[model samples]
Target: MKTNEEKKALVKQQYSELALSADELKGKCCCGTKPMSPAKKVFTIMSEDYSKLKGYEADADLGVGCGLPTEYAGIKEGDTVIDLGSGAGNDCFIARAETGESGRIIGIDFSPQMIERARKNATKRGYTNVVFIEGDIEEMPVPDNTADVVVSNCVLNLLPEKDKIFNEIYRVLKHGGHFCISDVVLNGMFPKEFTDNASMYAGCIASAIQKEDYLSEIKKANFEDIKIERTKTVVIPDDVLKEHLDEETIEKYKKGNVGIYSITVTGKRP
Candidate 1:
C-alpha cells in the first residue's frame, strides 16, 4: 500500500495532468466511466440544479462531483467562502454568485495545474473576488476564524486523512461558520476483492468508511447541527464491475456485502 504522502503526490499528479482537457477527463476518471455510462445514474438522485444558479464559466465543470454541496451551503452576500479542493472553480463560481460583489472567495486545491486553470477561468469572466490558490486542504494557508463558509464536492473522499481536513475546517471557520461538502461514504469497508484495486481508490471507493463513522468524525471535530442534506446510492453498473472483478466475486458482492452512497452533508462550528 502507498503511504499517505505518496498517495497525495499521486493524486496531485493525476488531477494536474487531467486538468489539460475536460473531454479526456470525463472519459478517463473514476473507474473509467464514460459519458452516458450507467455509472452516471448515481448522480441523478440528488444532482445539482446548476441551471437555477448563475456565473458559470465555460469548461469550468468537468462533471467530477457526485453531489452539489453548494446547493445547500446557504451562502449569503458578503460572506467569505472557502472552497476546499475547488477544481476548475466550478463550486467557487456558484458560491461567488451567492457571495456577490462585496464578498470574497478563496479556492484551494493541491493541484497546481488545476489552480492555473481556475485562475484563467476566473480572469475570463472578469471575476476579481475569486482567487484560486495551490494548497493542501488538510493544512491550508488560510487564517483561523476567517471563513464564513466552506464547501467541497466529491473531493474529500479521496483524502486519506479526513480528520485533519475536518479539523482544519473547524479551525479556519468563524465561530458561527459552517461547511457543506459532498462525498462518497460506504455502509461498510470494501472486501479484499475491491480494496486491492488502486483504480477504485482513485475513483472514491476504496477510501470510504461507514457513513456513521464519517458523521462521527465531523462531530468529533466540534461541528454541530450535522445533518445529511442529500443522499444517493451510486449503483456501479455490471459492465463497470466487469472491468474490475470476475463474475464470481461480483456475484458474491451482490449479496448485501457493501453499499456505496454519495452524500451532501452540512455542519456548523459551535
Candidate 2:
C-alpha cells in the first residue's frame, strides 16, 4: 500500500493527467478499458434526452456528472448559463440545447486538456452559442453579474478552497441568479487519516463537506431557497473500491458513511 503522502501525490498526478486526457482516464476507471458501466448508463440516458432538442449532440463526450443541473435549474430558451468545472463540455452542451439558439452557455475549467476537449466537441457539433474557457472556478475570470444561471456537476468537492468558490459564484451571478449543482456530501466525520488521504480527496469521496456544513456555507454566501432535490446512496464499484480502500474502508462505505449522492441545490442571490 502507498503511504498517505504518496497516495495524495498519486491522486493529484492522476487527475492532472485526467484533466489533460479524459479518454485515458476513462480507461482507468473501475470498468476498465471502457466507460464505467454505471456512468455510461447515466450518460446514455442523458444524451438521448438531450438529442431531441435541435443543435444538441447526443454523443457529446464522457458522461461525468453526479446530478442533472439543467433540469433542476429550469433553463429556458434565452437564459445565459455558466457551468463550473465543465469536464469535456457534457453539461455545457446539454445546457446549450436547453438555452436554444437565442441563449448562450459558458463553461469554465482549470484543466487545459478538458478545455481543449470541450472546444473541439463544440466545434464538431457546430454550436456557435457555446464557449468554454480555461480558468479556475474559485477565481472565475468572467465579469460580475453576467450570468442568469450557474451550474456544476460533481466538481465542487475537489477544490481546496471551497469558500472562495462559493464567493466567486456569488460574485458573478446576477441578483437572483440561480446556483444549482450535484456533488458528494459526507454523512459523518471521517478519521483524520482518511480525511487527509489525497487519493480519497481526488476520487470525490474524502474531500466532501458534511451535509449540514455544505448548506450552511451556501447560506453564509448569501444564498436563499436552498433545497436538496434528490438523494441516493452511491455504491462504490467493486473494482475501484478494492484498488484504493481496505476492508475497514469498504465497510465504512457500505454502512453509508461514504456514498455517492446527487442533490439539486438551488439558491438565489439576494
Candidate 3:
C-alpha cells in the first residue's frame, strides 16, 4: 500500500502532466482517458458552468472546480483570501476582483507546474496582489489566522486525512474567518471495483467518503455555522460504471443508493 504522502504525490503528478495545457486537462475524465465534450459530460460530473460567472480567465478555469466557491465566498475589498487548491488561479482571479486594490489573494497548490502557470497568469494580467504558493494543503506555508476567507475547488476529496486539512484551514484563518469550498462526496463507499481502481481514486470518486462524514470532520475541527451552499449529484454514466464492473454487479449497484455528489459548503471558525 502506498503511504498517504505517496498517494498525494501521485495526485500531484497526474495533475502536473494534465496541467501542460487547458486542452489536455479538458480531455481528462476521472479514471478514464476520454475527451470531455457536451456529448460525454464526465467533466460535467465534477465541474460547474463558469460561463455565466464574471471575472473569468480562459487559462485559469482549466475546467476545474465543482462549484463556484468564490461566488459565495463573501470576499470584501482589502480582504486576504486563500485558495486551497488554487489550480491555475481560476478562483484566485475571481476572488481578486472581489478583494480589489488593497486586498490580497493567495493560491496554494502542491504542483510546481500549476504554481508556475498561475504566477504567469497573474503577470499576464498585471495583477501584483495575487500570489501563488507551492505547498501541500495539510501543511500549508502560511501564517496563523492571516486569511479572512479560505476557498478550494474539487480538490480536498483526494486527500487521505481530511481532518488535518480542516485543522489547517482553521489554523490559517483569522478568528471569525469563513471558508467556501467545493468537492465531491460519497453517499457510501461505492463498489470495491471502483475503490480499488487507481484511476477512480485519482479521478475523484474512489477517494471520496460519505458526505456526512466529510462534514462531521469539519465540525470535529471546531468550525461552526457550517452549511451547504450548493449541492448537485454527479451522474456517472452506465458506460463509465461498466468500465469497472460486470453487468450483474452494475445492476446490483443500481438497486442500491450509491451516489457521488458535488457540494460547496461555507463554514466559520468562531
Candidate 4:
C-alpha cells in the first residue's frame, strides 16, 4: 500500500496528465481504452441550460461539472462573482453574462493548463467581463469581502484541505454573500483501500466526504442558512466498468459501494 503522501503525489500526477490529454479531458481513464463518456455526457446534460448565456458556448466543451452553480447563485447585473476551481471557465462565462458588461467575474484554479485554456476561451469569445487567475482555492489571492457571489462546480472534493477552502471562501465573500457549489458527496464511508486508491481519487470518486460531514464543515466555517438544493445519482455504465476494473473491483462498485453523486449546496457568509 502507498503512504498518504505517495497516494497524493500519484493522484496529482494522474490529474496533471489528465489536464493536457484530450482523451482524459473528455473523461476517459488514463489507460486510454475505457470510455468515461457517460460521465462527460451527464455533466453536459446538467449544464445544457447554461449554454443560452453569452460566452457560455466557448467554455462549455471544457466543462466537467455535474450541476450548474449560476442557477443557484442568483446572479444579477452589477454583481461581482468569484468562481473557485473555475476549470475551463464554464461557470465564469455564464456568470459574466448574468452580470453583463457592467459586472465582473473572477475565475481561479490551481491548474496552469486549465487557466490557460480558460483564458484562451475567454479571449476567443470576446469576454471582457471575465478574468482567469492561477491560484489555489484554499488560499485565494482575491481581496477579502469583495465577492457578492462565490461558486464552485464539482471541484471541492479534489482538495485535501477542505476546511481551509471553506474558510477562504467565507473570508472573500461580502457579508450576506452566497456560496453555491455543485460537488460529489459520499453517502457512506469508503473503505480504506478504496479511499487510498490513486486512480479512484483522481477520478473524483474516492475523495468524497459524507453528506453530514460536508455540511458540518461548512457550518464550522461559519456559513449560515445552509441548504442542499439538489441531489442526483450518476450511474457509471456497466461497459465502462468492465473496461476499467477487474471483476472484484466491479462488484465493489456495483453494490452502491462506489458511484458518482452530485449535490448543489448553498450557504451564506454572515
Model 4, 1-270: lDDT tens per residue? Answer: 666446445545654554576435553456767655643332333333455656566434454577877888888899999998887777888888789899989999877777887788889878888999988787899989989999998778876667989999999999989999998888755446556655566666667788788888899999999999988886655654454456776666566455457899999988
Judging by lDDT, tell me the better candidate of 1 and 2. 1
Task: State candidate 3's TM-score.
Answer: 0.90
* TM-score of each model, in listed order: 0.89, 0.81, 0.90, 0.84
Q: How accurate is candidate 3 locally (lDDT)?
A: 0.83
Model 1 ranges off by over 4 Å: 23-49
Clashes of 4: 0
Best candidate (score: TM-score): 3
lDDT of 1: 0.81
Model 2 spans > 4 angstroms off: 1-13, 19-21, 24-59, 251-260
Deviation from truth (RMSD, Å), model 3: 3.6
Give the Cα lDDT of each candidate: 0.81, 0.71, 0.83, 0.75
Candidate 4 runs further than 4 Å off: 1-12, 23-55, 58-60, 256-260
| Model 2 lDDT per residue over 174-265, tens place | 99888888877877656555666555566676667878888888888888888887775655566555556677866665665543455668
Q: lDDT per residue, candidate 1, 97-119, as tens digits? A: 89999999999999888998899
Answer with 3 or 4, whichever has the higher lDDT: 3
Q: After superposition, how far is residue 164 of candidate 1 from its true place, in Å?
A: 0.4
* Model 4 global lDDT (CA atoms, 0 to 1): 0.75
Candidate 2, residue 64: Cα displacement in angstroms equals 2.2
